[model samples]
Target: MSIATLSATPPPPSSRAARRTGRLFALTGAFVGVVYGYDTGSISGALVFLSRDFHLTEVEKGLVNSILVCGSIVGALIGGKLADALGRKAAMLIVAGSYAVFVALSALAPNVVVLDLVRFLLGVAIGISIVAAPLYVAESTPARIRGASVAAYQVATVAGIVITYFVNWGLSGGGHWRWMLGLSALPAALVLIPLLRLPDTPRWYVLKGRTERAVEVMAMTDPDVDPRAEVAAVSAALAEESGGSARSLLRKPYARAAFFVVGLGFFCQITGINAVTYYSPQIFEEMGFTGDGQNFLLPSFVQLASLAATVLAILVIDRLGRRVVLLCGIGTMVMMLAVLTAVFGTGELSGATTWIGFGAILLFTAAFNFGFGSLIWVYASEAFPAQLRSTGASVMLTADLVANLLIAQFFPSLMAWAGAARTFAGLAALALAALVFASATAPETKGRQLEEIQGYWRNGGRWPVAPEPREVSPGPLSPTGPAGCAERGA
Candidate 1:
């Protein structure tokens, strides 16, 4: 069935139980974010102490920070392929196992080389988690709350970052960077227990020719939707094309989805969010917060702001829609970046204007979490047809990681050569680009079924290929049905 046919009639409101059921599947997948957020943010404070221990040059510090992203690229490529083969559940298990080993190894490294190498391996775990976890949530849940479900991944990630910021603050006094790095192992390992109980996504089951199993899993996770209908929808999407791979994403129909995801991710990263995330302490220090532990302390609040905004985003994304939220956020970022760039150029950020800079960063954090942080995963999960979902996610995330790598590697040098003012000016230019790109290319995916979303791409990259979904009256559903969790996943 084409999306126009499948979605011709509106769905009634899902029962509380069904909503909870889908959320269970999504949140379980989202737990990977705990480790992902912690690992990603831990370095911000840890770098301060780690550099002291390693006596590292500026270039080496960049290398240490960026090597993990390189591993993530590798992991995305490998994990995307394996998730297609073994299943999302099995791929997550692999991610969990790698995190268990490599994080411990990272904690116990004997030298900078060992630390860099081990961190690279840990990044592989993160890479796989990013690819698999959000995909799991999106495929496992009902379309009614799919936006919230996928946003759960981002929620978990921001929550993880919040936890790490506090951890970093607590450990900063003693400079216990090793303990900070090692603590991520527990959450990374803990994801296994829940994943063990959960089934692989129904879509993956159907793709693997396990019809009976697919129906069974859907009944458990998305009881609000009829199993037969979902199976047909997946079959139709799969029928459109087969034998997909990374190369296949470049072909017609799939090509536009590929470009959209890759483009969104590229612009999102180039906005220099990670420059703040990875080096906030240094940025804070440069911004003149020289109090005891203020660098660590303030960024914790910044992470908290991001966490709160992500939560708010989760509650309303399905209603307010993706493109509007993204444009608003990116627009805020462009303004904040331009103003901050000008402020930094003045070199007079003492007293009142210093607080203005702080407010601007806070706005930037909220704007990012509100749009780019959460919706990126949501959009990536829904953009492609079933045959290429995993491959497309991998390619999209790989492009994201590539841009992330460029920032991690060169940000310090950029800071050195251009100074904060010009560096932010450059980012402001990129943010303007991101805003323009999003306005031009991002199609709203809210309230659309997975099959319907693919239909949008198939019908020449335009939305509303079919009629809009209507909110209808409530209907009877299993009271025992549950919903999914929040994961920035990936």
Candidate 2:
């Protein structure tokens, strides 16, 4: 297949089968999100009880949270390579099984050291899942609905968070944090059964030179399309990719895309979303919501708001495009954070001021979920060529995990040292940076075919340059001046 033979348009799918396959993949892949959400959310409520049981100091408590993040960083670093080597389905299966085992182990931990080790191991699964699940969805699904399909994973994540909050609320009375952490393992086990049966993506098969298998999966995934054509197109695109290496990503077009993705990943965490999610109870307590019911209820409301906004993103992402939604969401977050900073910075918290802070935090939650939260995975999944997609997504996810680790370790102390207002204000500054970055560098990948998107960066980070102009002989309307110069009608 030649460059000229490459089609900018994605091959059309049999509507019914495509929809079926897409929905199935989206739902099953979302188990990754479920594990992530439960892991991240369960700790917030569990930490309170864990602290009491272990007589933990503040720094020790922070370690319990930060160790998972450090594990996630390690996971993200290795996950891409694992996915590429083992295939996406296998990687996800490994992640699910790990989640099941490690989460259960976490519940049984006798000391903070053991708990930290288990949680960190779980984080590695999380890091691998985040990369593999989205990569599978991106590679398997049709381009037309890719954004929403990928965003569905996030919806599952938010749903998992919401479910954990309710679990936290229900169990808070008994101080049964063990049960709270143990509950996540059940879902992890359930998701694994389906993942075990799922097929590796057609693209991955093609990458492995198994064209017959690729065609078979493609037919099942999109029955109306000519499997041969689809396979050939993917093969042609793969042929153009340089030998897959971390070094290749550092050069030219991949480097440019990497910068944008890594920046987004950093900003996503530094903007304080995770800090708020992980420490919502702490934040609420500081806001004068000391009652047990108030402590659990408020964070539920925040997660609910986040879940709703993620649904909204799913509806409009492909239509509104990635850049528009990202800028709007980040801009909204910055504004809400500004409100929070102003309310908290001035003085003591009154009832009215507390309500204002609550409102601002909820709005910020909605805005972050509506924009960057949903789109970051979508963007990372599609930005690189198929050959490097998994590795590329891993790189970006690793950046996100790195940011998460920093925020997790220091956010509490930062809040203590700087005060809530200044801490939020600092996040607002990061949000502002995110908004600017999205506006200037984020690619508009709303409806483009993956190959078409790869083509954008194939020529060393710029669109292919047009050919040089050729000289034209003087025409009837032309006026000749010096030597051989010719002027046209103009």
Clash-forming residue pairs, model 2: none
| Each prediction's whole-model lDDT (CA) | 0.81, 0.81
lDDT per residue (tens digit) for residues 1-490 in model 1: 2323433333333566656777778777667877788889888888898899989877888998899999888887777667889998898889887887888888888899999999898888888787787778878888877866776777788888889889989989999989988897877778788878878887898778776667666666675677767877887777765766888878888788889999998887878888888988888777767863888998888888988888888777778998888898899999999878877877856877777788788889889988898778678778876567656766777778999999998898788778999999999999999988898889987788987788788778876443344444555542222321111110
Q: How many steric clashes between backbone atoms does each model show?
A: 23, 0
Candidate 2, number of clashes: 0
Kindly state the number of residue pairs that clash in model 1: 23
- What is the per-residue lDDT of model 2 for residues 1-490, given as tens digits with 9 covering 90 to 100? 3323434434445669667876677788877787788888899888888889999876777788889988888877877778878898889889989988999999999999999999889888887776677788878876666766776777888989998888888888888899989998888889877777668888888878777777767776765567668887887877876467767788876888888888898898888888877888888888767776678778898899999998988788889998899988999999999999998886878778899889998999999999988888778877787667656766777788778888888888888888988888889998898888888888788788986677666655454454544466778644354333432312
Give candidate 2 misplaced runs (Cα > 4 Å): 1-22, 142-146, 253-256, 378-391, 443-490
